[model samples]
Target chain A: MINLLFLPLVIPLATAVACLLAWKNQGLQRIISLIGSFLLLIAAAVLLVTVQQDGVLSVQGGGWAAPFGITLVADLFSALMVCVAAGMGLVVAIYSLADTEAEYERLGYHPLMQVLMLGVCGSFLTGDIFNLYVWFETMLIASFVLLAMGGKRAQMEGAIKYVVLNLIASALFLAAVGILYGVAGTLNMADLARMLRESESSGPIPVIAILFFIAFGIKAAVFPLFFWLPASYHTAPMAVTTIFSALLTKVGVYALIRIFTLVFFAELAAWQPYVLAIAGLTMVIGVLGAVAQDEMRRLLSFHIVSQIGYLIMGLGLLTPLALGGAIYFMVHVIAAKSALFLATGMVLRLTGTTELKKLGGLYRHQPLLAGLFLVAALALAGIPPLSGFWAKLALIWSGLESGNHYLVVAVALLVSLLTLFSMTKIWAAAFWKGAVVNGATDTPLPLSRRVYWQMAVPTALLTATTVLIGLWPEPLYALCMDAARQLLVPDAYIFAVLGVQP
Target chain B: MSSIILSTTIRLLLPLLLLFSVFLLLRGHNEPGGGFVGGLVAAAAISLYALAEGVAAAHRILIVNPRQLIASGLLVALSSGVIPLMTGRPFQSGLWLPYSLPVLGHVGTPLLFDLGVYLLVAGMALLIVLSLMEEE
Candidate 1:
């Protein structure tokens, strides 16, 4: 069904509305959100399959032609992204059933979460630059509320930093869009790509590209502009943080890849060195930040930043192999990272805190959770036979093949080691080491059996996904390679959207 | 802080402002006025009434909960987009009536979409204003 292209955006919007309508009944809201998320996952999967079979698919809104009306196109890259995002949304929806407090539900957590999904999916599927900006704002506003839902002191402080920095990024994005439109006279990405490629004069495009870089870099949490991530990610509820960790930065990276390959492909060579350098720095600094953290979610937050480096590294390499690696790495990281956060959420539920030093003896008390954490943690560290290993291998292989990118490869390897070390630090301190003889451990909070299972199931499911991808990497890897080819050669995408053979 | 002059003026002004907002909403299809500005005018009128009377009276006058208004407005807008899909058109394709109505001119999905935006914006503004005023 061609109309399936709009389902990813529509399903979530409808779900959020349904949740809002059932506001007074928290139980009803939960059921609605869960079903909505499940339906979204199915729709996304169908969309992905349709795209895989049909090549790039584009739909114009309100019966208008592309380059004029709003367009939603799904090539392999976007379809895959939407699929993974919907999967993450489903997992988080399940986890939120038990993880979210009734008060937050009353405060519209379910609807806000669905709105966030809508924004994320819209960003992935939109074919217009200005439309992408609108989706980003939609995601931003939903996340802002989700972050500060409880109005806790730390959340407020964190939300302020998050909002202000993100607002600046949005402003930059808008300015870039305005400038680009002024120069090219079109906001449709395919039209822009064709115009930019055909135009003899390339004046001011580089400036616009750099503006987009900084704007998206802030969202992606690349080296210099990633301060807001760690400052705020841990302050939100774990489920919120999990979704944020899974989708938000990846959206930024996806935008980077999309624009660099499509609209700004010409300027990529001029900007390659800067991107690679930033990737290296982001990886090193993020892991180092993780090593210094004793809090559970905070450590994971830093790791999120570090892993973003690898995604960017793939982009910087600018080869089909490298881009495929980056896409694969994105899927791997979403599963592995979200699992880690969900497990940490479990730890918080049982222990009432995420401070690693104050947590111990989990290996004895809750071996299942400990095991789940270990699997995801090792995956994050790029252990063998795990999704992360293959992701890293592909990136490293491409880096070496690219030649002269050895420094980043080395940084990446070293960062993997450091990531392992940080994971071990968490394992040793929180799970392996004996419980601290403090008031915090004397009386563990009694987690209801249902809640425990609800939290654990999603974590285990995600871990299983990582293990599955790790064990059977061929299908996903092939998809990513095809996606990479589509990205590298933009003519197909351009033609699909505008009905003109570029 | 309630003033008799302000209250008396608002009682007469509220209906006129609301009628003006509807005019703006209908005229938006061909003119500069649209749902967003129209919603703002309506919200401003109601808020002014709240200031003269009280938040409780304003809530009573509104009848429906602002939150419900937002939810329903969103549903309306979404359905407008979906209507074209059933008719074998792309999602959100504007489908207008062949015949133009008196005063309103041509009616279409765009008008319905604008109506949704009108309700949503008005509800959103009122919700914020009422909450903030109640907090004070």
Candidate 2:
């Protein structure tokens, strides 16, 4: 049963290879990639179901026992994350059928996308911390190539900034990993957590945690570490940008949540205040940055940074309810944010530009498209009966229950207002206003209905999922509660992976 | 790049480097010479061929694209992981044949996994190097 964990990673990787083999035939590449993603979706769903039934599941690599050889472990949190990522993979694969250019298809875009999914699934499943780093590198390289595949000037510029900063973060991560292994004598996460708890003097553990913070912080795009995100995210192709926006920083956030809860839970008392401060600042700065942006993608990119702050805020609160809220919020953002990006891509396709000044009359021209955008936009801004509302409300309620930081509640509410403001700004500039009467480039023809359906279908599906979750938050919330329980008290995870008491 | 002595030396050394790379790959499971090092050695051989005979000649000898090598290698590695699952074992658990092979002896999934890694590393390195060399 534990072997089932490998299916998610293996399926994508094999499918990536299949896609590459069929590189000359773009249609075959698409078909193979789609099959691979579909298989992965099934695998992730099975893994989630198995974990729920069997409790935390772990597999020892090469038949080696825990703490000696590599291990792949999955609890509720990892399983749910894998499922969401695979779902995103399936959605993006469908979207790419219409959105990816033929040139990109020939240049191995399908394979790279699959490989990116491989990295994501691998990262979510690996129990060994070092293996996680390898997965991060895998995701990084694939994304780097995808980002600059078109060789546009803006893309090259963005790719360079993205790669350089990430490389720095990688170096820091490796150094920290080295030191951590030195201290713990093991690289398996469960082992490290057990050892850290047993060790009498944790004087150096905080320093190491800070290293991980910076490493993951940069990747998560929190506050001061977020500069590279806005610069690079807007320049990729629609499919590439959408996946990167949905998955990349979220992986970083996952790492943060995992490391903090499992390995660093005992030390949270020292770190909680700092984390809360960082959370507040990240939200405020990210939304303000979004408010200043004119380009549709850049604005959304900055919003990613702000949303990350909320996830971290859940961590800062150090309560099960708060963490559950964070998990729920993560699910909501993944669906809503991707929907927003895809909707923007559709608008760009119709108008031939994503610049707010150049885009208008979307409401007049395409009411369906405008409505889809509003669904995602309203959800993002925490409107009632949308996914974001529940996510925000949960976090606020937990913050109030904690009764430590009244300011955090205030900042979060204020950020919601600002989020609405920015969404309104996009709505006004791109939808409500009439298209500016510029010359020849002003009025590009809309795509054929069939092609429009190709794009609209995925966007519509994502929006529906968002609204569905908002209306019936019971199932998702229950899952988050279980995941949060597993995270808060990681004895189940450790026992599953190591088969021993701490 | 234009030096005759250097080109001739590389041409002479290429076969030896490739042979040694294979040897390293075979011995990698229990020793220092694993798939990663072997792949680097193999890539170095390919790089030498590119330097000596030029990128076109290297491509001609390569026959299949390096990308195909990478993709095939990944599939092979993935298969090694899946092979264990056939026995109802956990993923990535080593699966061994009941009898010993004549030369390599006791062939197992771990070695196959390493072989996959070897091809992937060599292919990835050559892909990047050859692409750059061709551009130049």
Candidate 3:
């Protein structure tokens, strides 16, 4: 029962310990990490199935119920997110085995990666706001270590900016949590949601909500607060960047969606317009920034900002369909974007640089790699029959159904085209053009079969998932719909966490 | 580089600081002092020793790796949660001994969990300090 909920958190933490113990043994560390990640995926899948069958599942810590103690709750949305996060964990662990240097392994890379997943799973599964903050700190600390591990000048620069900005974000979130607890006399999210609704006092509540909005906004990299993301994301190791792209910002978006829907449902009208405007600006600015980038990972990092804009846009529209679309978009983008980053990593591995100006002839040298990148890129641009297209269709249909946001709908279309343009720019420069005879391409050696499988297999696995989800999106869509239904009517979650009468 | 006065002062103060940290850790469950504060106190004591006796001496005193302490602490904390699951209870439930224990009275899983936190924080602080000292 509730033991099931603890598995995801426990597995990673246990693995992290094993990894630390195996610090001198890189091969053993990799094996343990892989097995742990595999177990996490299985646990998450089981949790999702259980929550799907049982509605919402909540477990109280130390037998203390509701507002009295910490809880771990897995509604459909959180469960799905956990499943996706674990999937990323597994893939990144595999990718790291091939890509990370031995020096990093000695410096506790595997353990930190495991701890990072632990924090992510904890964040997605926790039922208390303060617990969420703790999990955020856990994730941030692990990420800080991972980002700065190499101690290169570029890494130090990026890590400093990332560290400073995220510290500000954490402080804001903590301050807001303190104010919220003071106002509501509780730290449990369900209890606060209930209390915030019942008490007709909306004075400090709106101000508190604004603080939360800004806090999560910075984490989510929405419009005005996104400068830190592109600056730092490109500088991390490829495996590190892939996992960061997959889970970090999405956690922020998940927080926004969770709080806005559950706690701030009553105040949607006050915030909807602002959320919408931010979404639109985030989309425009992010893609425009991507278009101007010449480096592969930097451009992809900017695209992360733009895709986040779309996810937030669905929440802004505030309908079941739109929310469903947002959740669907989040999952699709996680898969597609991780695949793209892995592919970019492969390009960097082969060509020794991610600079579009220097990278070329990938199509000639590695057609499979080129094809996988194309699939992810096309999927990202919302091409037909891909996962992104269906996700966008759902959002746009919801937009039209809600009436008179024609401009927003048009902007969504424009962003997709711009996404297409930048992706094609990568394709043309990195794959289609003739080989660049430069310092970056000194030898141009082909990978061995083992090396190819170790590297390409993970990207191929992720790309195949994107294609599979694209071709048969019905099951995922249904899950998103169920998740959306739960968000729209949170009585199930509230009751699950706070009991029937609370 | 160290002064005899500094060394002598630390030799006298370190044991008291460590004793106070243990006192703080034991009283944490019902009082204001907890694992985090106690761990910081212990780390401060270690830092003081490092400053007085040089980092090489401090390293000899701390024979085990700080990373191992962290890992063990986390494992203990996670085990505290998982053990309750075996008895059909929720995570981290306060399972107690049927009889009162000698010296430390009425021991339970919450105390064990706090001990885990204590080790983790102390290890983390030591790791940072040792790494910084190494860099210098």
Candidate 4:
């Protein structure tokens, strides 16, 4: 069972190699990618179940002992993250069959996508901070290439912004790691937690903590660091964008949660107010940015930033309920946001544009697509009986329970309302309004029925996942609560990784 | 660069550089030289050849696609890791043979892994350099 912990990392890597081996045959690459994704999903599910049963499963790379060698640990939180990431990988792989062009596939898209999965799953599962940095680099390189694959003028512009900002983040992250090693003398997360808790020296720890915050903050795309996201995300192909929406920022949030809970537990209280302030501003600014956008994808991209604020809010509250709510919110938002992006991709395909002024009457022409978009949109807006509503409810409930956070709670509520308004803004302009008489709008792209099903099915599956989670939030919430508990009490994690009683 | 002097120097230098890179790969286990540095040297050799000759000539000399080399190298590295798994050890645990070779010390999975890295680095570098050169 412990061996299964690394399967999430290994399977995607093997699949990427297989894809690369079959590079010339796009058809073969697609088939191999799909199969690989399915296997990964299964492996992730098994790993999640193993973690549920075993408490925390860790494996040392090359049979090295903990704190001395690289460790891959799968606690409930990492397991849940890996599971969701794998599911998204499979869904996007399926979606790519219809959405990705032959030219893109020929440019090594399939292998790069698997490599991206490998990096994501590796980041989630690694028990070492330096290992996490390596995975982040792997993910960054793959995403940079995927972003710039076509080398279109816009793509080049977007990729340049994306890479420059991300490289800065990577540099800061590495610098922080180096300083941290100088301070703590170890890169193992479990060991660091133990040392930080036991140490009397408070010097430079706070600075290191802040540096980490900034590094991950940029990746998470919080306030004042999110310019690259909207500038770049809308420029990528939709399949690439869909996976990025599901994974990239979430990985940053995951890293923040992991490092803060496990290593910086002593400093979280001191940082709470500032974290809350940042959270509130991120929510307001992101939604306002969305409200100002007329393009479909750019608006959704802004919403990704807004939703990240809520995740930070949960972390700020620092209560188990708040953290659990954040975890549940992460799962909900990935499904909801990916569904929205996939549906928008379909819109882009049918209308040859995602511009609101040029896109109209989708409700009349492709009612199914409109309905798919509406389900995901409503979920994003926190409507009843959808995943987002339950996520928000849990977060808000946790906020109210954690006293003296009323202002941010009010901000959260207002953000939800604004989210709804902007979602409807897309609906009113792109779907409910009359179709424009422009030449591009008049001639919808001719999509084959098979390709249409390929695209629609993945979007539907993701939407269904959101609806299912909303309708039956109990199991997931319970698991998330368990994860939150484990995160708050780091002794179990430390014991699992370092075999030491803290 | 169609300089006769540069091309003649590259022709004489290429075989020696390739041999030196292999030596580096083999000595990497206990020495400063390793797969990464070795691969870089080898890539420099090939890239210099491309500069002296042309990318088309370099491609003809390479025979196999750099992309294929990358894939095969990754496979080799992955298999090195998996070899330990078959023996029920953790992934990437080094497994050595009973006897040592002439120049290469105790033959092991780590060496095979290094070889894979060597091939992959060389392929990746060549791919980048060749493409950029082609664009020009």
lDDT of each: 0.94, 0.90, 0.91, 0.93
Clashes of 4: 0
Model 4 misplaced regions, further than 4 Å: A439-441, B1-12
Candidate numbers, best DockQ first, in rank order: 1, 4, 3, 2
What tens digits encode model 1's per-residue C-alpha lDDT throughout B6-84?
Answer: 9999989999999999999988988899889899999999999999999999999999989998998899999999999
Q: After superposing candidate 3, which stretches have Cα over 4 Å from the reference? A: A437-442, B2-20, B31-34, B44-53, B134-136
Candidate 2 lDDT tens digits, A342-402: 9999988888888888777778778998999999999999999999999998899999998
1 versus 3: better DockQ goes to: 1
A1-502 per-residue lDDT for model 3 (tens digits) = 7679888888999999999877778899999999999999999999999999988999898888777877899999999999999999999988887889988888889999999999999999999999999999999999999999989999999999999999999999999999988888888989987887777846798888888989999989999999999999999899999999999999999999999898887676567877888898899999999999999999999999999989989999989999999999999999999999999998888878899988777787789999999999999999989999999999999989989777778888899999999999998999988878873554566766777678898999899988999999999999999999999889999999888643
On lDDT, the stronger of 3 and 4 is 4
Q: After superposition, how far is residue B88 of candidate 2 from its true place, in Å?
A: 1.7
**lDDT for predicted candidate 2 compared with the true structure:** 0.90
- Stronger candidate by TM-score (1 vs 3): 1
Model 1: DockQ score: 0.85
Per-residue lDDT of A1-502 in model 4, one digit per residue for the tens?
Answer: 4568768888999999999989888899999999999999999998898889889888898888988877999999999999999999999999999999988988999999999999999999999999999999999999999999999999999999999999999999999999999988999999999988888538999999999999999999989898899999999999999999899999999999999999987777788999999999999999999999999999999999999999999999999999999999999999999999999999999988899988888788888988999999999999999999988998899889878899999999999999999999999899898878873456778999999999999999999999999999999999999999999997888998888799
Output the better candidate (1/4) by DockQ: 1
For residues B1-136, write the lDDT of model 2, one tens digit per residue. Answer: 6778878898779889999999999998887898889999999998888888899989888898998888888878888888888888876788889999998988899888899999899999999999999898
Q: For model 4, name the residue pairs that clash.
A: none
Predicted model with the maximum TM-score: 1
The worst-scoring run of ten residues by lDDT in candidate 3 chain A lies at A439-448
